[model samples]
Structure formats: C-alpha cells, structure tokens
Target chain A: MNGLDPGPLLFFVFGWFFALNIKGITDRTYRQASRFVPMIGGSVTLRIMGWIWIFVGGTLLALDFLG
Target chain B: MGAGWGGGGIGYSITLAETQTPDGKTQIGILTSKSVHSAGADFGLSATAGKFYSNADDIGQLEGKGLDKGGSAKFGLGLYGNHQTEVGTTNSKGEGVNVIEYGLGAGLGAEIGGGYSDAKSRWQTEIGSDKK
Candidate 1:
C-alpha cells in the first residue's frame, strides 16, 4: 500500500540474525582466534557490544531504506 | 600481578534498543552499560532500557514515551577489540609448551549476538570461553 523496500527488510533480517547468534559466533571466534593470535579479551563485553552494533546498525539501516 | 590474572578494568558501551508495547508498537533509542572486569577474565555489562508499559488504548500518549520511559527493557550482543603487548605466562598446565610475553591482546574482535526474554526481562547469552 505505502512504500516498504525489501532491501531494508533484508538488512534488518541480517542484523537480527547477527544480533541473535552473536554468542556462538563470538565464542568460536575468540576461543580459536586466541590460540593463533594469542591475547586476553573479555567475552561477555564482546557479546554485549556486538549485540549493540547489530541492533543499532540494523535499525538505522532500516530507517534509511524506508526514508 | 604475575600473569595468572590481573586487575579488573572498567568499560562502557552504547547500543540501540527498542520497546514493544501491548498495542504492538516499537521505538528505537540508545542503550548504555558500564562494567568492571578482570584484565585476564570475563566481563558483563548491560543497561536498563526503560520502565514497564501501562495504559492501553492511548496511542497519542504512547509516542511521548519515546524511549524515555515506559515499555520493557531490551538487550543486545557486544564485541570489542583491544591491542596489547603483554602476555607473561604459559596458560597451559602441561610442560613443553610455548606462549608469549608480548603478543596480540584481546578486546577488539567482533561478533553477532542475540538473547532470550523472560516475563519481565531479557537475558543475553554470552560466548567465547573454554571452547577451544
């Protein structure tokens, strides 16, 4: 009826997926990555921040697409 | 501090958050968190997005809430990266192993995250520990 772009919807969905599955992805990346890379990092912090990025980024992207 | 585990560091983050009303409406805004964590351990930080949502059949008044108040709290995933030059211990228990004294530090990695919600709150699931 109005104007709803599928592209923004896709981005929003992608951001949702990333935000939703950040735990698994962060765990795997840090655990295995630490071995070769060798470093000490905060796990929970990473998850929280990653979640923030995906959510914020996704929201703004969706707004941009629609507006 | 001889590399077993050092002191905790304070951290802060800002994220996007939204709220869902009984009428099925949502708005986006900032979510900030502050935390303290060990230099050699894990850290958790979160922000309370908003207050409870009340008053049905008041769409006009709801827009005023606008992330300032009302609705339920929201949660999100987090990831960070830090560049450091110190690793002065062999984390492994066994012998015949080599580590680093000044290698790549953590706190600068990125990942996607999600969470589960209960009756009044949303709980975020943490990742990246003992998965090796």
Candidate 2:
C-alpha cells in the first residue's frame, strides 16, 4: 500500500463523470469552454470525455510507476 | 442479443454458475441468436469439443431502450433467454441449468455486472438506458 492510491480516486472521478454525463453538464461545459467539437448530447459528448479521462488516468498511472 | 416489452420495458440480471465438477473436464461450444421484439430463438451445435451435432435451437429476444427519464433518473432493464441441446463439445452432463440475474446501471454508464456459469445452463440480464 503506497498510502492513498490514486487508482480509486480515478474510479471515483469516473463515477462523477457518469453523473455529469447523465446530467449533461460536462459536455455543455466543455463545449462552452473549449473549441473541441460542437455541443452534442450527453450520450455522445460525455462518452468522448470518458475516453479522455481514461487516457489521462493511464498516463498518470504510468508516471507514478516510473517515478 | 434480446428484446423485451413490459411496463415500458426494463429489469436486471444476475447469473450464478458453478464449475464443471466430476471429471474436471471442460468443453467449449458456439452460440448464435436473432431476436425481433423480445422473442426469438438460437440454433447451434456442440459435442464435447470433439464431436459436432447439428440442429439445436431455442427461444430468445432482443432488448433495447433510449434515455428513459423516470423522476429525473434515467434507467431501464432488458432480459432474454435461449433453449439448448447437447451439441458441439460441451461435456458437462445433466439437464441444462436455469438462472436469473439483475443489474443496475446508474449515472452515465456506470454498469456493474455479476453472474454465474455452470456446466449445463445459461441466462442473462442487463440494466441501463440511453436517453440521448
């Protein structure tokens, strides 16, 4: 145990993202804040974000292991 | 694959399975299904991974839903099944087993799945909805 594993934290964030997806806010916020893609419904928009979040988590895990 | 209709259509699935006891021997098989409105059948073959039988079929369904909003929460359930025969290479003996499973997917796509598989029977259930 390395004390406070971020893996669970990442999972919690995924849960949050799920809620945001259902609520359809994350996509709206991203649309207003960035130039990524036009505002789409939560179904399509949030899933894309979820993929990004997974990639970010993987990168963080890799860095943690490397360090 | 399956389809269902009832109370706007929805439910959950949780299947339990036991290991192939006795001979500690295991076999594999193939499955194919087609459903058009929560009702259909599957036909395939199996024979202990060594022999091959022909002409086996069973009933099943195809299930689907789109973003059903129930009291601010969107969710639903789908169920399907199949009848089988001793075709192909599955060597588990005894009558086919029966199972029922329920799942609850919430928030975005927060899907949690758990089920059981045995030597002779099969069942499946899914929980969730798409409202976009």
Candidate 3:
C-alpha cells in the first residue's frame, strides 16, 4: 500500500496466470495435433506466443520484486 | 499440438509475429501453411525469423551501431481449402454414393501488443555519461 500499488500487483499476477494457462493449453494442443494430424502445426506458433507472454509476465513480476 | 476432426475437410493458415527488444530494436517472423486439409489425414508447417540491431565499435562508433528498444505487434491469418466425400444409403438393389460439397476460404486477423522495460538501464547510462 505504501511503495507499490495493489492495482499493478494484481494485474501482474493475473497476467502471469493467464500466460501459464495459455502455455499449457498450447503445449497440449501442439502435442496432440503433431501426433495424429502430421500436417497440422497448431502447437508451434501458439506455443511460441505463449512462451513470449510467460517471459514478459515473468519479467514484470521480477521488476516488481526489485522495486 | 491442436487436434480436431470434422468429417473430411482441408484448411490453411498464416501467422506473423513482431517483437521489440529492450534496446528499441524490432524483430519479425512469418509463418505460412501449405497443405492444411486432407481426406482422412492432416498436415502443418512452422517457420520463424528473428533480427536485432548491431553497431560497430571504434570507427563504427562514430557511424553509430547499437541496439535500440522499440515496440511491435503481431498479426495472423488462416486460409482453408477442403474436399469431402461421403456414402449414402442404396435404394433397392441399386448402389448409391454421395459426393460431399467442399470448398476453400481465407481468414484474416490482426492484434496489437507491446511491452515496456524498466528505464533504469537508460537512466544509469545517462547519469554515468553526464557531462556536468
């Protein structure tokens, strides 16, 4: 309540959660598609974006910690 | 790893991504799907590209070469081509085969997202090189 505001903190946490969920879903989707479909690359791009979000969210959380 | 089945069909997809570095440089990647639809089968492909700024030192320093941080967004599109076949009930002693209708389509999309990093690095450099 003093140094860091609760609003940004909550936002960061929510972002992190969303990112993790996306990553998990994408990973599963990719694996399944790759196995059966053979031609469907559903997992690769989505997973890449998922990782990007995870990294960005992690960096934000890290900044909050350092702050 | 996406898997879904709907009778028999074909589809295609294209995706593009752009990211900005902390130093203000932008990177872009493009991916396109060649064959997405097949009868009793599926296929896919993935491609990526990444680039960053590079500056030389000494004499190059006079010319200026360094990484810069900026902002970027990503866009994606999907195209679909399909063909399907089916079998229908035979009438009496006759044989019957149904030819299902199949077609192609194009999908388009765009998204804008960016990030900001801590300004400490720039600030520190500025303060360290202060002429005052």
lDDT of 2 by residue, A1-67 (tens): 6643444245335635633465665555445433533322434444543544444444444545665
What DockQ class does candidate 1 belong to?
incorrect
- Specify the poorest-scoring 10-residue window by lDDT in model 1 chain B: B65-74
Looking at candidate 2 chain B, the ten consecutive residues that score lowest on lDDT are: B40-49
Better of 2 and 3 by TM-score: 3
Candidate 3 lDDT over B32-109, as tens digits, reads 222222232222221123331222111111111111122112211133221211123232234331111112211112
Tens digits of per-residue lDDT, candidate 2, B72-121, equal 11121112222323223222343332322222221121112221112322
Cα lDDT for residue B62, model 3? 14
Candidate 3 reaches a DockQ of: 0.02
Candidate 3: residue A24 lDDT (0-100): 71
The lDDT leader among the candidates is: 1
List runs of model 1 lying over 4 Å from the truth: A1-19, B1-132
Model 3, residue B25: C-alpha shift (Å): 17
Candidate 2 CA-lDDT value? 0.28
Name model 2 segments beyond 4 Å from true.
Answer: A1-67, B1-21, B24-91, B107-132
lDDT of each model, Cα atoms only? 0.31, 0.28, 0.28
